[model samples]
Target chain A: MKSLIGWGVKPVDSHVNEKNDKAWTFKQKLFLGLTPGQYLGQALRNPFNWILGIIFAVGLPLIAYRYFFGLGAVTHASNDYPWGLFLGFGLFVMVPLSASGFMLGTTVEIFGRHDFEPIERLALLNGLLGYFFAVVYLLIDLGQPWRLPYPMFVSFGPAAVLFLVAWHVATYLSVQVAEVSVSFFEWIGWLGGKRFIRRIAIGLTVSGIILSTLHQGALGALFNYAPGKVHPLWYSPFQWIHFFCSSIPAGLCMVIVVSTIVKKTMAWRCDSNFSDNLDRCTLGLAKGASLALITYLVIKLIGIAHDNEWGYLATGWGAWFLLEMAVGVVLPIILFAYAIRHQVVKVARLGAMITVLGIALNRLNTALIAFNWQLYQEIPHIFEVIIAVTIFAIYIVVYRFILYRLPILYSWKAQPEEALAAEAVRPAPIRTTPSPAGAMYRKID
Target chain B: MSGISRRRFLAASVAGCAATTLAGPRKALASGTFSGYPDGMGVLVDLTRCVGCRSCEAACNKEQKLPAPDRPFDDMSVFDETFHDGKQKRRPDENAYTVVNRYNPEGGAPVYRKVQCNHCNEPACLSSCFVNAYTKTEEGAVVYNSKVCVGCRTCMVACPFHVPAYSYSSSLDPVIKKCIFCYDTRLKNGLPPACVDICPQEALTFGKRKDLIKIGHQRIETHPGRYVARLYGEKELGGTSWMYLAPVAFDQVGFDPTPGNEPIINNVKDFLGTVPMVLAIWPAMFTGFHLLAKKQKGHDDHEHDAEQQQGEDGGEQ
Candidate 1:
């Protein structure tokens, strides 16, 4: 019967119906319980929607063209560079960032670090959206997008590293979905569903850790097939270890980055538990990230040493490689250490941003830029770039959609006594008065 | 009780280690590298004897039932067709099963080299395919089944020769297109491929793989001045079925000389070895850590409880 706006703190009514009859209808909830005019005003006001509008204008048509004319229409379609930005960014960059799900799941459930409980759902949601969008990007890139499940039920090539990646990612996507569904159930006021998931939470988290570990590593191992193609500086025999280790920092830092964004943009959605514990969690994650960065740095150096490639550090590619390490790895490591020691959350946030960029650079280097070091570089087609950015924009829109309605950034407010009373009596006093802040909430609320 | 428990834990860990070691998945690597099927048919291309004729290309095009080229086979002007990168050389692609490129040496006469699937003893495309879409038949042809192809194009990345080309233009039935050594029609019947059979200059010599290696070496040995000392593909990428004795260095003739002797799959074995270990160990090990943390917490509180008991006993005394 009460408004959901600024009702972030509890002791609030659970339903948004005027007569307090039942919960808000699905359509009402979708519009955030706002009138159609208010929803349109909100959509028109935001600058980000305009950017998304332009992207879709160009990209959506190109995407349609791609399907009608084939991959050749949007991509350079060079046989020399079989993989372009679609797999390079979509699969490689996105998968590591999505590793946050398993990282937080292990911290809270397996290790009993309940201090991390507040942000656990956020990390899981970030992971789910990242992976879900990665698959979306893949769908755009695949020649036969419809036949994605052929490796699972129809055919088998168990010996390939990609086979391992295909199987593990498929399994892990389900694991992440199950892990995040608890929050979904709570938001929908399904207490029974939440309780059932809670019972299987540990098993799901364990499988998550297992699946995340293998697939993250397996992605790197995919490059092993091209021993001669990739630059030696980027390629290593221990590439799987490098990828897995880097993802640790990548995952932890992503949580910091997402939390910072949520705090800045939508602090109204955050409950005290999330908003209050966020700084402490940032520092905790920074510490974990620093440890991972150091491990990643060492293994990377060790990889070079193992291959007797110390001489490469002086070449042009080596300089480029060093730049990647300095910007993506070393700079973040220093910032994270300084931030953790000084208890400065902002520096940690900055480090997280840099770490994210660094991971993206690393994946792009491995999959595209530094790949085929001896051959001429292949630039992504303009439409390909537009389509990729457009897909990512859609990802952000879906992510924000869920964050607004779900119990991800905040706990669901469940007033059981009010619910019981509403059930017992009909035509009760409706608490539908909107707060002044609800005006802003009503539009983009 | 502590000592006995420690002994039991150690025994359990050892037994667990042994069980995993014994029950480990069959070694995908370390099963010994394949040396290609014995009596596998192969082609020995003697570059010194070949003229830059397009008969083999035309035969391959016709035998494979490929679509007509923009420039017909008789048009020598196609040789001057430069790609976007300005390299006039053409490699194999979806429409063409094989191509002959003319490499103009600085002083010597122009040398023409034919490029097709090398069909390595351990074909990277076959190993990297997750759908089992590729097969290296015992007859030395690396063939593909498009019905099972998922179109991931990992084979495109895996092929050191860059032989596999995807039909990205065909949305309805896009698949990899490459030379198959005429496996279904000729090689299966113990006859040479159409390209080898149609080489009027006798540039391509078809024979058993081992016999070809011997012939390649003998040619290089007898005609040392005419041919390069090394036979390309004999030890490259664990020995492809197609061996070449070029007049100039292999690199000069458009062959990649830097591919290490080991096959591409060998590079991935170390990571594959770790998969089972992580899959087997992570569950119990993490659960153990979880239980240990729980026990440590309980033990800390119990220690405090014991101290209180001790104080009560002291007061009673």
Candidate 2:
């Protein structure tokens, strides 16, 4: 067999191979390593970067304009539709999709499903970045972002559902950071740090599960505050359950979608184990997602029935709701189930895409479209859309940077394993590379 | 089955049946009840008596220390004001704390309804605020503090009455602007709010919530055919600190008739009750499945090891 890297392939001295690359150091990795020149090079290489550049050029000044002028400048500033895409998409949708961290953590660590070990770190990383960016989106939306910690150490709203969400999301972000830090520990050659995390891995996974379940559900419950405001088809007293249940599939399918994207775009970064088992794992994950989607579809109907909202099914909003259900929920479920059973990997990938769109649509419906059902619709400002896109671009850039360096995609080269073994077994320390996969494999167990 | 075990099963079944029967009716009973504190204060504003004098709007603006409006307080031309969409009425904004909207019902002169915070007995804004920015005082006023507010605007989403307006222009120190029911100026001192006190036609009545309900009923009874059969806010959404007596139906003036008698918080309680259950149950259930799977994997590994050893022995022989 021909070597995968052909003889004609140039040994490019990319940033990945640079000596004293800042990303290799503990301090630099913490900052997301790149020399200022290399960072700018990567930014200029991608066409998406040009789009982001255009967006920030227009949006950053507009954001500053908003602060200098007012929200009225960038937004419609209607009393009827107070919350636009910022809260709608940024907070509601982003939070639930980011639930991937806890769901995958619970499966791999708490449930001891070592077969899922390959993508576990990716899921954790996806979650941490998603949440960190969600907060960033929030800072832009908040009238007073500086006071974000007020709900915690400051005045506490113990009785509010939002209060619960605020506390849990803050705590859960910390939990996810701890969960993903194992990879960072290995990259920095902190063996002691890695071992300590391994010992408490189960506890962290369990806590992640608990926190994810509550806050994801809590986001939906936030809508329950506006019983009359949200359309009947979308509103249910059991909305929390609907949000929580749908998030399972959303989170699961998000991993499949992200991994698929990574496989296509950054194949060099992925290790052999991850690339080899990906097809089987994708099928397995799609099966789980399909089951969750079916449950979600049934419960969604049950919620409508429980609220006795059959009359709403005849309306225009009802048609839109049905379309969302048919396309986002039912279609994806059918495709995923069919694709998984038939071993059609491409079809399963398509289904995962549909599921991602479905989650976004459901969130958009709840937050923006269905909200203020009686009021005129408020389209987000052009600048607002640009800013949202720009932020997402930044998210992808950060995601790519981490994947290129972290042991998350590629297993770390163990440092002088023979020396450690000989030091324990004999007086002489013979140096050799340790089994790179052993730490992660054992920690996953 | 053993006799002891059979008897225990029978006893458990009987106890379960009895417990279900006892609990079933109690759950239904809890869902139907609605009552506010007997002494909670309330306001009753009669639309028929309101002259559209703009006195209440002026009083509210002055008392709240809100910024000056573009038009003078005495400008009746403001009543004929239209929005950019040509909607013939302007609502209260960040600058104006309160505005009276004129709705011309069929066969009736324009009926003016003052729009401000209803200060519900169970304020949705108070419950929805993540930082506890709002306070629903026992005096039947819903007040807020700007200091600790993250300005998430969740309260704006939660308010059923669509009352809270954000100071979006004030980038440095934006806060929610809404009616506080004069908690600091009057309600705490046992006086009526500025709007109520300054009503020249006595259109606004201030009293205990229970007494306000009675007074509203008395006016309807005396006139018999003058007012609608319903007293707006007497029972809507668990009742509001401010009530209304209009000759026309409440919905004709944009009041949501179907808010139900129960407070908005009651709708949220069902979900809140499940939070603790999910937190407690999911960890153990997932961990149990993990252990079972691990045990199965161990068994499979052990059997495979034994089979390999047998193959090795045959090769040696």
Indicate which candidate wins on lDDT: 1
lDDT tens digits, residues A143-228, model 2? 88888888777887766787777777887787788888888776766555664455456567766777787788889998998988
Give lDDT tens digits, candidate 2, residues B1-317: 12332343234323322311232232233344345566778889898888888999999989989878898888888777766455336766788878988888989888988888888887888877777788777778889998888888888888888889888777788888888888998899998899998989999999998899889999999997789888889888888888999989888876887788878888877866666566547656755665565566765334323433343343346
10 residues in a row with least lDDT, candidate 2 chain A: A8-17
For model 1, what is the alpha-carbon lDDT of residue B100?
Answer: 86
Candidate 2: CAPRI quality band: acceptable
Give Cα distance to truth, residue B4, candidate 2, Å.
38
DockQ of structure 1 = 0.31
Candidate 1 colliding pairs: A1-A15, A441-A445
CA lDDT of every candidate: 0.80, 0.75
**Which lDDT tens digits does candidate 1 get at residues B153-227?**
999999999899988888667889999999998999999999999898899999999999888888878888998
lDDT of 1 by residue, A234-332 (tens): 999888989999998888888899899989887767767678788988999999999999999999989999999989999999999999999999999
Q: Point out where model 2 deviates above 4 Å.
A: A1-44, A418-445, B1-37, B80-89, B299-317
Q: How good is model 2 by TM-score? A: 0.87
